[model samples]
Target: MGQHEKVATSLADAVGEEIGASLAPVDAELERLYPGDPGTRQPVHTVYVPGDAFAADTVRSWGDRALDALDAHAPDAASFAAVLGLADDLAEPVYARVRAKLEREPVEDLRVDFEDGYGPRPDDEEDQAAARAARLLAEASARGTAPPYSGIRMKCMEAPVRARGIRTLDVFLTGLLASGGLPDGLVLTLPKVTYAEQVTAMARLLEAFERTHGLRPGRLGFEIQIETSQAILAADGTATVARMIQAAEGRATGLHYGTFDYSACLGVSAAHQASDHPAADHAKAVMQVAAAGTGVRVCDGSTNVLPVGPAAQVHAAWRLHYGLTRRALARAYYQGWDMHPGHLPTRYAAVFAFYREGFAQASARLARYANRAGGDVMDEPATAKALSGYLLRGLDCGALDTGEVARLTGLTRADLESFAVPRRGDLTASSG
Candidate 1:
């Protein structure tokens, strides 16, 4: 067999074995309880760093500086709003001192670390943490401010090991959920996922949590971090990811490309060069393809290097480049993560750019239809015909706003109503 075929066979076998070993009888109770998407609905962009990277002092300093910089540069209500939200959480007073210096700072996505292993927690500790996180969330929610997006990166099983014990992993995840559930669309990022069973195990825990908390079933969602040699070698990696999504039913929301782990697995130099190496690209493609049309988002991993200088220009440029790359990915139907607060601009830049481009293209197309001939002022049939094509194309490409379509087409609000109405008959007939 060809190399690709060989790889496919191996992955299929591995996944099959995992599923066979772990698959429980279908839970009709669970399925009926959670019938639709039950978790955070917003698109996720996580910011991750090792917890050990900062001491208590550094965190305080950084938090302070971030708040100060945000106050000055945000310049608008929404921007200022996000800045103010971080005021209490900035790492240090120095961060606050320099906060005024940073402009257009990014909002924190999800924070990640492996400070604790995945295992069960004492009920008391779990309750305390849950209460704390809940209080913070309530305060933020009441202020109409977004909470800091957070997540935990648990320890990965070392290689040469047959499999990581599921019970150990379960305890860890249980503590997180029981600790007052994840804060507003919390993401549990699993590293080094090599088989579908790993995804299933996680999903099952979420199911159990939903039962215990009286939360809607499937409310516990997670993003899988693909970073293993065996995972990359799978020809059907994309399909595997898709299957995982199906298994989750609706809790799964995003897939992230884990560059460092995958690189180490392949014996590639785990350096700056590895971020976008060919293998990494291949793995990203697998994730993208699998996530396509599933409504589950995908994100490219971070650039390990950090930029320097106070001008924020260097940082801005890095962000812009990163945003552009992410925009390209988004255009292909994927979004990426910004690992640091500094990368926030890049994240927003990419999202806004995509929306702007999509809007512009959609407008241009609709304008063509608005000017088409058929009647005194405009041709209803001709215009409708023209618009039908534009509207479908726009929606397909993630240009989700229909109001913009109405504005550009000059179609009466009523005529545009049919924009969302599914088309019947041939494209030409439907338009007429």
Candidate 2:
């Protein structure tokens, strides 16, 4: 028995050293790039308009028009409320809140699209459009009508259009910078990136723009469109998103999904290209995983169900758009593309309802977990983090004010403000 006990053991105990020391640099990198909380404000939806159609008051005008259309189409907030599955009594109040938000901050983000929205144009016409867009952007900034997040989307840098895309972007940026420099929250959108080299090239171009405009090194970040199958899945089935990010060299601020293009690449017909399609989900999931912890925001694609035509048609379209937007919100993809002015109201409505409906239960669950009440309910750390995030999102999107969030969550303004980064031991405690 003594001899058996004295037998050699292959297991070894960990030495007295810092296990995370070697990972210090890696952790620092991940934190620097994608901190537990990215303090940037993400809009509910980004309204995309043709480049030539952009104007200083586009967002405000769109909001006003959307409100009128909503009023006329629904005849009462309750009419649309029925569509949203909200209570009849709550409809007017919700509608008022959404209307106010739209008026005050009608567009949180705007993409002056030059790709699909603008389509092909003569070289001269394109340049003129770019210049006009630049002038309007400056006017919007001066008039304080520019959305918090505003930028332009250039054509894809692919063959037969690479030179044209770069020219349009250059012309636009040159004119924009001439007015001063990149406006606050400005970001360019690069479409159809099939390889990492495309992102690297765009980064270099952005760096040049910064230098030429006498702006900061990272002032000109861009959002890449994950449209083509090649962008989401390589020939060998390896994800191309991480490679794209690495190539961007920290200039990739966002990744936007393009439903139709991605679906077309998957051989899906026009009828099948939809925001909630499995193919779109697969592309966005790849985007989420690759861009996670990298500070690159992921945006869901737009719904093609535009609210137009007769009243019944508009209602039908609104219902579809509302459903798609809600689906995106439930997936934690807050930002999306809004194709028309009518989508503005529905966008805000869905976001507000999402918060309002979940507020009470989320707050109670969070408080209960924090207080260790253990009322047969439990939440993981990720759940707690997400709960806080929902509130933060509400506050950022103007759905909830500081006072409201404080009262609802029983957290101070400061605590709610730093909800992005929570204390490890106490989930309610913020580490701002």
**Highest TM-score scorer:** 2
Query: Each candidate: RMSD to true structure?
Result: 14.0, 5.5
Q: Write model 1 residue lDDT over 233-342, tens digit each, in one string.
A: 55653456656666665667677777677777778875534556787777777777666545566777666554335535534544544544544454453445554454
Please provide, for model 2 over 238-314, each residue's C-alpha lDDT reduced to its tens digit, 9 standing for 90 to 100.
Answer: 89887898898878888999888889989998988998988888889899988876778899999888898998888
Query: Could you tell me which residue pairs clash in candidate 2?
Result: none
Residue 359 Cα positional deviation in candidate 1, in Å, after optimal superposition: 3.3
| C-alpha TM-scores of all predictions | 0.58, 0.89
- Please identify model 1 stretches exceeding 4 Å from their true place: 1-44, 49-108, 115-135, 148-151, 155-184, 235-239, 272-275, 310-327, 330-334, 366-406, 409-432
Residue 22 in candidate 1 has what lDDT? 69
Alpha-carbon deviation at 366 in model 1, angstroms: 4.6
| Best-fitting candidate, scored by lDDT | 2
